[model samples]
Target: MVSLEVVHASNARLKELGPGLVALFVGATSGIGEYTAKAFVHNAISPRVYIVGRNQDAANRIIKECETANKDGKVEFIKADVSELSEVDRVCKEIAKKEKHLNLIFQTQGNLNLRGRDESSEGLDRKMALNYYSRMRFISNLLPLLRTATTTPPHFSRSVSVLGSGGGTALDTADLDLKNTFTGSRCAGHTITMNDLMTTEFAQRESGITFSHCAPGAVKTNLARELPFWARTATKVLYQLITPLTVGQDETGARQLFMATSGIYPPSKPVEGAASASGVSPDKTIEVTKGASGSVGDGGYNLTWKGGVTNGKMLPEYRQNGVSKTVWEHTMNVFARVEKINQERGNVK
Candidate 1:
């Protein structure tokens, strides 16, 4: 495991690299997303960043802090309810119009949704949609920009989704939505599996993108408050019971910044159509954890909170039964059906 000191050192190195980078922060109004965004601004070189969320006040506060932290960092806040696919599409289009290439996308756009599976106007479970579909929608819509965004070697591009990345459970393929059978635990597992499988498939197909879905273990953040009164109280009690394991906000931010910029997740060779970035890569001086595929320097990674890959026993069932590909197909199908219906209803946005 990489030490926090090393992580902080790597982040600080990005400052001297000079900046012509663009980053989009979704669901950064609070929690890990906010912390990570601020950390990036504090260390990044004169980067232009877009922070997206529903709360203007939180966005303004974050932007102001980023300005104070890094005088040259251009921080802009765009408000949107990203739980809806329409809104996700709209935000992507807006960004596409302004920037031709997007260098980094640090997405933490999800809530715990412990109140249970609520349905949005889009008819999908609101929590699942936010965690899986909405996040993927943002990526799919902005992939062109990500490709255009890659500027230098060593830096390449990165998309880090902060969620459960190392745990897996029996994914009921019959009920991807958990409609006929729904439980809070089951829903969480399904999304984790979806995240894992999607990122896995994406890594193979798009080697230019440095992709990761990380489980942040336990962290002190506002996400705990999203649970219902009883559930929230239970979580707090659990946190108190396991205080030693819980990561501090600043440390979590440093680790996240390491994931976003460290050399550990560089793109593949030119056969993958990207000139394998070469230069003074941070973490080059230290042993960096390999990509999620278990090989050194692969583009995709699924890591624990401590930057180690542990794909739990249950995930192999997904690969053995071709469940990962099954999920890739199912997710694409869902987006297709939803977009087609939305377009037919003149709700394309």
Candidate 2:
């Protein structure tokens, strides 16, 4: 586990990489996303940040606090129901129009619920949509700007998704979307596995940008608001009991900022001896962890909450079985189908 002090030290150097860092925070209205947005605003130098989510009130509050934290940083709230792919595209289009390049994309958009298979208007299970499909859509749409971020280690273009990373099981490829077997648990498992696959695939294809699927660990967030009353009560009680063990929201934000800027998860095509460029001497530079493809600096990482690699025992098997390619093809097909339908409906341009 990386210590909070180390995380803070690394983040404190974000300014050394240069200023005018552009970032997009999907689902920053509350919880981890909000905290990380605040951290970015507090630490980054003259950052232009976008806060995208459904809650304007919450976004407004966050934006106000961010502005107070860094008067030079510009934080804009973009109202978006990102669970819908069309909306994700629209949000991405808005950002693309405004920014020439993006330095980081941090996403923590998901709901914790036991409800079974709630479908979105687009015919996707709402939980899966929020956790998987919508995130991929945002990344795909904004990838052009991400690719344009020409920077050195610790401040390159990167996308970090806070979800179940190493905690996925082998997928049932026949039911990748879990349309037929749509239990809440199955939906969660499928989305988790799909995130891993998608991250791996994107890292392999997009050589310069880094992709990470990370477990947020035991951070106290309001993710369980959608749970049943009994479940919500239980979580509250459990949270109190485990208060000493859980990382504080502020510290979690610092750690997440560390993941976003640290050279430990370098891009696939790393600059020769790039560790020295991360605002630290070579001897003092943090070691680079292996990516999801079992290669050092391969650009995809499944990270633990403490900034270590996850013990994804199923990842190797999934790779050998070519599941990443299968998942990518299926996801792209779904995106194409949804885009065509939304265009016909005049819901998206």
Candidate 3:
């Protein structure tokens, strides 16, 4: 594994890959998503970026900043609440109508925590709908566009979900939807697990589209506001204490961009040096890297602020339960139901 150094936002390395890329950022009105979008715009020479958010005014402000930062890049704002399926469908439809393909989709729209259970008008839990299901809805709706984008030379398209990928514990497959059982932590854990299961399923099915679920260690963003008063205060205290150790927003954005553009994590490439840009010889350990304490590896790429891929052992329980396939089928069923209902209402025509 290679150690990636953290750098300032104005570094020239970021600009090297941003030009000509078409990216859609959901939940970018604030927090890490906004910072990531700004980083891309700053580095891009002539990129077309779509900013999706609930607040039109805020979204416009972000786009203006992006334009000011990179005069050559084109920025457009799509105002919508991504938690709503109808809104997600409409936003994606507009994109399809305006652009031929999408090079990258960064799904960062999610509520950190709800003080109490809340449901959207669509009759779904607000957090679950926004954090997990809505993202999958957007991806399923836009899969064709993503595939079309990669048809040409140097085919590259990626879907990146910003969430926890390394820790899969406390994931209750029985409560995937959170209809009967729901708590702040349980909902959060389920969201991460569902994203992992769905992403891996999509990777296996859609060979051309690269999928990644990044667990951003920590970044100071407005997302902490979603927590209750006590929780928010506790989080603020911890954040202030840990900000020095956390990855900066720009570095987080660059790592995400690397995941999208870098030819790492390929399905067919011999899993040696698969993540290295230098094309060095592969490592022999079952794990990607061996630490002084022990070998550190996750079956998939578990990246740090610097873009290194490592492997780790899967829990025997999770491996034995075969949750991936179950989640896959369950998610598809939900999508099918939503599609059918939308069709009946003439929303999917």
Candidate 4:
């Protein structure tokens, strides 16, 4: 496995990698997302970025930070709640209309410590909708635009989701939607694991798109703020104990920036350096071979924070029961249903 060293966020290499690239960041109001956006803007040669968040004031602050980092790059913020399908659809449509293609989509939107299962006004579980389904919907709605942006020069557009990689022990096919199975604090854990599985399954079926599900390990972010009081206190204590081992916010951003631009991960690359030599390669690695059109193969990647690709043990289950196909069909069905509902409500333009 490639040893991923923690580098300074202002590394000069990032600037060389980011010219003319357009990236959209969702859930970047704070945490790893926010730091990554700032790092990208700072190090990119001349990047145009779109920051998505629910808070206008926070988004504007992020934009200002980006502007200060690199005066040459353009930064724009789109305010929206990514958990809502209608809002995601609207934002994606606006992006599609404005740009011919998008180079990267970073999904870091999340609220851990959700006390209970809450459904959005659009009739879906809020956590699941935001962490999984909404991201899928964004990809589906903007796929055509992504395809249009790919030219002979090979402008690769990648979709990177920040969460757990590989199947968590808690995942169950029966409770894919988490409606009837699992409850309590484990619900968030289940949601994260299921989303990882679904993301891998979906990316495998959608060739040409580079998909990566990364586990950020543990960074001190605002993620724990939503936890119940006791849980929050416990987590803080735990973080204090493990702070030395955890990655910092700026380091997380640098790793993400590398994932967004590095050609080392193309579909045709070998997996020699991708796998970890020990301990469930924190960097989940998989190789995607290119097809005749130079698009990636069906299998997506599961990566660690450091950019190493490692496979989880549960992969065989997905391949055996055809979970990949099942996930694709189910996700598309959800998108279709959501689209129909939105249209009926006159929400889609």
Instruction: Please write out the lDDT profile of model 4 over residues 74-187, one tens digit for every residue.
Output: 988888888889999889889988888776788888777655667665667777887788777777777776555444123456677887765355455566667766454455
Q: Model 3, which residues run further than 4 Å from truth?
A: 5-19, 228-231, 267-305, 309-321, 340-349
lDDT of 4 at 108: 82
Model 1 CA lDDT for position 246: 82
**Model 1, 152-248: lDDT tens per residue?**
4323667888888877577888888777777778877888878877777777777777788888778877776566788888888888898898898
| Worst-scoring 10-residue span by lDDT in model 1 | 271-280
Better of 1 and 4 by TM-score: 1
TM-score of each: 0.92, 0.94, 0.81, 0.83
Compared with the true structure, all predictions reach lDDT values of: 0.78, 0.83, 0.67, 0.67
How many backbone clashes can be found in candidate 2?
0
> Which residue pairs come into collision in candidate 3?
297-311, 297-312, 298-311, 298-312
Candidate 2: lDDT of 207? 83
Worst 10 residues of 4 by lDDT: 275-284
State candidate 3's TM-score: 0.81
Model 1 CA lDDT for position 317? 69
Backbone clash count for every predicted candidate, in the order shown: 1, 0, 4, 10
Cand. 4 Cα-lDDT: 0.67
Q: After superposition, how far is residue 254 of candidate 2 from its true place, in Å?
A: 0.8
Residue-wise C-alpha lDDT for candidate 2, range 1-349, written one tens digit per residue: 6777788888887776667888999988988999999999998888999999888889888988998999999999899777788888888888988988888889999888987888876878888899999999889988888877744334368898988788876688898888898887777778888888788899888888889998888899989988999999999999999999998989889888888778777778754454423322211545777888888878888888888888468778878888789999999999998888888888984
